[model samples]
Target chain A: MKRIRTAVQIIFTIFTNGYAYGFLRGKIYQGNLKYACVPGLNCYSCPGAVGSCPLGALQALLNRRGFQVPFAMLGFFFLFGSLFGRFICGWLCPFGLVQDLLHKIPLSRKRKRLPFHHILKYGKYVVLICLVGAGSLFLFGGFAKVPAFCKYLCPSGTLFGALPLLASNEALRDQAGGLFSWKLGILIVLLILSVKVYRPFCQYLCPLGAIYGWFNRFSLVQVHWEKERCISCGACQRACPVDLAPEEISRSAECIRCGKCAAACPEGCLHFSKKPGPNPDTKPDLKPEKRT
Target chain B: MNVMNQWNQKGGSRQHGSRGWLFGLLVGAAFLCIGGIRGELAVIWQKAVMICMECIGIG
Candidate 1:
């Protein structure tokens, strides 16, 4: 299942960024497909990107001259969030794949949670509300509006959009200045942290993840936990990359639906299901067996 | 008690059944149609086709 997921991630990444000619010529694809927004945190400026990024589209809509509600982008978010929630983060995001691969490297002992993980996870929400929401809507320079998150924070843009563009376009490289350096520095730190942590960016910084996470409890696709099944072995908790407990597996906003917990379950209790079962947060009457 | 036990004891789960998702899908579709009618998709196309300098952290 993990292999299949990895294959899907790779294939989707390639499909989203499939315009070989754009990469070769150091130009972005100016196609009709750009009208549609992709579900993940892919960069719109990526040379080969076939679709606009949802976050970028939202920011652009908010930053427009006339202040209007971003109904289209909100619709896109609602539609995607209802369907899969953060399953898109787990299986579709190119940056997630990069972080997954980086964590596999034997650079240091892999940690499940970062320091102050509980408090720090809320950072993504702060970023979403402040940078993507308020910064785009309020901050302006005379006639120009700034997409604050894209300009300052989005490591996906730095990695997939800027680096690829710079590598192929000498003009773009020559134009690189202090701003580019700052973004690059952020990208470097994130990439390095990926080796020691499981998706630090997704856990702490991604606005898209913050948005999709809200729908995890109500999404069509979901992880179902069967309370009747015997044995509350800690395997599922141990296997969970993000440190989510068995009870939290079904409804937790942080769950990316990677299926590692389900796979790790010794009893055939935990499973992914489209059909709704018992409420995820319902506690079992059976007590957990004391481990010697 | 372990962290899981502590969390389970706290028990503040909000329940939204299958109807919730169905309603969400309908709302999303309706909003999408309205936005399309307003030519918001064309705005997205126009913005996306051009190289976003800010996206690349350049300008």
Candidate 2:
């Protein structure tokens, strides 16, 4: 099933990316399924998407079209975030899988993020403000365009989401201007570096990751461990793809709850419980690990 | 004794959890807001939300 899902992931990503890049990135796909909601970070602009992407929907809502709150998208994210946290970052995201593959190269010189990068992570907020603030202004301004995020920054949309589609569509290619070129160049750099740098986009610039990460600590889905049961061997922390210290914040919103930590626990000390479950997401072992 | 201790522990846990959550939330939210403001992370959030939804679904 995992292998099949992985294959499905690739197929959906490649297909959607082809269509998004070639045919419908800047333009919305008129197809019903394309406008329908899909689960992962597939672009709404991609021709294969049936529903709109929540981020795109959020940006659209940030613009305050007809006074809608993007309830579907917002609720969707909340329900998902509250349940799985960063689990999405692990098993599902096409981009994430891409980064994992990149990390497979053994010869790359690895570098831990700089101390100042903690500050740099804040840059995603600026990106959000500019996109949402400016995008909303389209209501009154003459320069209204597709939300800036899609146009400027998203590598998934550019490389895996948009470029393939654009390559097949002459109209899109002919229409390719400075903006498209600029977005493409950005994607090229990020894609090339993601393997070496360990999801630089997610670590540094992903506004969505930032948002979901905020809710990770309190989200209903959480990881709890019996610290007393823990041998302090550090296996869970070492298994984390993001290099986060899982033992420190097993329930951390920054944690995708990928279960890698639990899977890696040599002592079988780490266990997960649902929020409605007993005092989970903690390092204490009182009675037992009650499965939520 | 057990009830009193549980209450105290709960209080302490809430306090600590709130602090950790607040710190993470503030930092993460700040990054998101800043990224949104800069217009660089427009699409990442949408895709992320969708991915989060699917994650919870299958998870």
TM per prediction: 0.93, 0.69
- DockQ, candidate no. 2: 0.05
Question: Which CAPRI quality tier does the interface of model 2 achieve?
Answer: incorrect
lDDT of 1 by residue, A1-292 (tens): 7898899999999999998888888899999998899889999899989999999999988988779988898888889898898999999999999999999999899997799998999999999999999989987756788999999999999998999899999999999999999999999999999999999999999999999998887788888887778377778889999998777777687999999988889887888887444655565655675555
- Model 1 sits at a Cα RMSD from the real structure of 3.6
Q: What would the per-residue lDDT of candidate 1 be over residues B10-55, giving only the tens digit for each residue?
A: 5422335465677678788888888888888988898889888888
**Model 1 ranges with Cα > 4 A deviation:** A285-292, B1-15
Per-prediction tally of clashes: 0, 46
Candidate 1 similarity to native, TM-score: 0.93
Which candidate leads the pack in TM-score? 1
Q: Residue B10, candidate 2: how far off, in angstroms? A: 7.8
Tens digit of per-residue lDDT, candidate 2, span A1-292: 3355456557756654443432443344454343334445556544444455656666655544344334444555555665556666655666777766676677678643534776876776676667544644453434433455655576666654455556555565565567666777777787678657767777777777766775565555567666666666677778765666644455444565566677788777666664321233344433444444
Pull out the clashing pairs in model 1.
Answer: none
